[model samples]
Target chain A: MTMALAGWLSREAAVIAVPVISLAFGCLVGYLAQRSGFCSIGGFRDFFLFRHTRLLKGYAALVIGAFAAFLVFWLATPAAFEHFPWALTSGLSPVPGAPAGLEAAAYIVLAVIGGIGVGIIGVLLGGCPLRQLTMTSEGNLKALFFVIGMAIGSVIFSALVQGWVVSVMKGIAW
Target chain B: MNKEPEERTSARALAKTPVFVGALVGILAAAVQGLLASAGGPEAYGFCVACHTRDLVNSAVNALAGTSLTVAPISKNAVLPFLTIVGVLIGALAAARVNGEFRVKKGSLTSYAWYAAGGVLFMVFALLMGGCPYRVALRVGYIDIVAVIGLAGIVAGIIAGTKIAVACVERGE
Candidate 1:
């Protein structure tokens, strides 16, 4: 449907419009998310700190709703999962299990480190990327600074820390 | 204080419900993000906050410095007049306008440092994780097992952070 619509417009317009359309989708989602008070860390934090589950229910809704949407889209077009397509217990699949050998161990370690790191920071900052965007849009200086830090951190990771990470992984194997 | 008329719209009334609003946004996000994911768009490109926004900032920095230090791909080649972040900003701006929720508050430098530190932690480790918390959900929707593991870690980390927050609140007493 999107491609078909894009075909009518000029090439340049189509190119320019896709990202905008994508952002528009994100915008609607972000706006709705903010208005509804759905946040990533807020959900878990509420459940933990206040024993509140309203936000957690929102989180659950996000998960189940998004998963069902993905399944529907996927059933129509299986190629979207080409990078790492979902398997329905297809025993002859190539994707490795998480409990395997050294590579699996490395994945586990990285996944653990990555999740804990983002989770803590997300809780501290009071929002994830989506929430941050909402805050920044509302002209929150703190959110903007957090974004600045994110930019710096991303640059540092790409330019320097990525190499260090590779070395650390190599060391783990050695 | 009586609010502005637009601020009291039916949309706002409907949005107060977490489950309904959440499901609507989820379905909306998933439709675009999931389809694009298969249509050969960027990885998790639909609604990634860190990657898209960071890429925009990086491009601006590079342009100002007269360098092209692209550590990742961007939507520059697309026909959009600006980065996707711009779209988000506009969307958010509009929402804030409607909700009358725009506010700019700066905290003490100590808090700024704390917030920035948290940002660093988030962006740095998210790169390692290959996605942020939302992206983790997106990946899990695709049945990526690695993301499921990351979700566990996120739970643990949230628990740890919650404990710390509680401790700090108690200490302030």
Candidate 2:
């Protein structure tokens, strides 16, 4: 089958196939996320607000599953090591296009500020972006709006503040 | 312990199962991601909620600027996170269905608006921080100390939000 298909398409087609498969996988996972009610933000919110933890369990399950898959892939496939390098350094010189390394202190500050926003918004929205997607699949019309809003927000951040981000990051210590 | 009615499982019990399951799932997802990364894919990340969010951001900016660049390279990376998210939805839907918890109820218009606004806020923060709550936790599990700080911030934020929410509820405003 591989030989027959190879004959039909160029080498580029074969390379593109990986992403095609990945998209299909993404859609399937999106569907599953919609069904599962597994939002990390939601899990934390519930724990604090209602003292519930069902959503947290689902989160745990996903992490466990991914870890197991990683270990197996690592052991069985020599190529896997290449993808998961220990220190992601590509030669003594930093990659030309790589973002400047921000200071650790800056990272902490940004993370804290951003995290607060994320937490508050997530709770207000009843879930995180992942949860919103999952909720949409489960037939929550509201979540659809949330997704749209997220897209819009992403646009706003990138278009308006990317320069600022680069500058801020550059000024910070790595 | 006193047994409540059959329909009433304690919150504590319900919480335990899901947390356990979520942690396990998270670990598994990370492992697969690591493997995929090692196999000539991205490094130190197989799944990143915030990175994808940035991709979305980039795509949108390019589109508005009339550039040919696609904002989200969703098609170019390990999309397992997207899949896992979908899985959660399906799982939730199935659970809701079986438990007779499925309801087509509508919340207040104000509530819906708030939710949308909140989503926007989340996107902004996620892009700024370079990861979402799930990614933060996953990074922590992988022993990324930086992620631990993010997690701490997230928890602190949650506590603050909860308090504010309670205050709002009490005020009925």
Candidate 3:
């Protein structure tokens, strides 16, 4: 349905409007998340370290809210069903003609490895990315540095490592 | 003469009101966001952390090239999220003012460096997976099973990470 709306709207409007909505959505989520103390990393950390579940409750609420909303949207809109066309494929699938399934698996493996690294770093850094953003919005200068680092790293990845990154990602599962 | 009890009562009342207001604000903000997204605003995401992170990336890339790059179509839909961030700042500030919890705190150099490293790791993983943990949860809510798998991986990683952090702290690192 979102795609359909994108098609219905002029290309310019769709391009402009979609991001506006996306940003708005992010800001709101960040705000609510900060206010509610919803940090998944913190949740796990607190639970494992201190056997506290207060933070975990926030994470649970977020998941529940998201699931309920998703269900209602899926049921209400036929177009939403169309969005999950690739829901059942195993391993990783390429952009059709790019590589074998193994290559896609490689990407997932890299992602997982990277995910682990992110988790460790999040623990050391005092928050996950979402938490960092929320903390930054709440005027924590420390989180601002993390956000800056993310932007810099992403640019560096795109500029220098795009092909290597894609290839390694492709090669692993294959 | 009898100001102590009165002050304590006022403080308790003040604390209770903001908690109530914050909860209402949060739920209302979330519901509004869901409604907008449900009205065909986006796919598997009415709110996306990864996409905004990507937007920041895209913006940086464009700035580097000495050309003003346009915001992507997907990113334009981030209204409530942005406002929410602003609202969060206001809320935090207000709470701090009322409760006197505001203070300037700094971390050690090691902690700062670790934060930078963590930021890089988060960016790389987020780009690869096409979302962050929040987005992963949102994806699951949308019944995207891939996101569910990713969330599982995240949990596993978090557990391992917690163990490592505990070890490091114990070792005085």
Top candidate when judged by lDDT against the true structure: 1
Candidate rank order under TM-score: 1, 3, 2
Which rank order by DockQ, best down to worst? 1, 2, 3
Clashing residue pairs, backbone N/CA/C < 3 A, model 1: A15-B79, A16-B79, A16-B80, A80-B38
Q: After superposition, how far is residue B134 of candidate 3 from its true place, in Å?
A: 0.6
Error of 3 at A3 (Å): 6.8
Encode model 2's per-residue lDDT on A64-113: one tens digit a residue: 55545545555565343342222132322211111235555566667778
Retained true contacts (fraction), each candidate: 0.56, 0.40, 0.25
The Cα RMSD across the true interface for model 3 is: 5.6
Give the TM-scores of the predictions, in the order they appear. 0.81, 0.69, 0.72
Q: Rate the local accuracy (lDDT) of all candidates.
A: 0.65, 0.55, 0.54
Tens digits of per-residue lDDT for model 2, B1-173: 76666535543244335554455445544544432332233333445555554554454455567753323332233232233333444555655565565666566787678767766777778766667776665554444555556677877887888888889899996
Error of 1 at B115 (Å): 1.7
Which is better, 2 or 3, measured by DockQ?
A: 2
Cα lDDT of model 1 by residue, B57-89, tens digit: 656766687755443432445433225566666
Q: Report DockQ per prediction, comma-separated.
A: 0.47, 0.27, 0.25
Which parts of model 1 are misplaced by more than 4 Å?
A1-17, A83-104, B1-10, B34-44, B59-82
TM-score values for chain B across all models:
0.75, 0.67, 0.63
Query: Model 2 chain A, poorest ten-residue lDDT window?
Result: A1-10
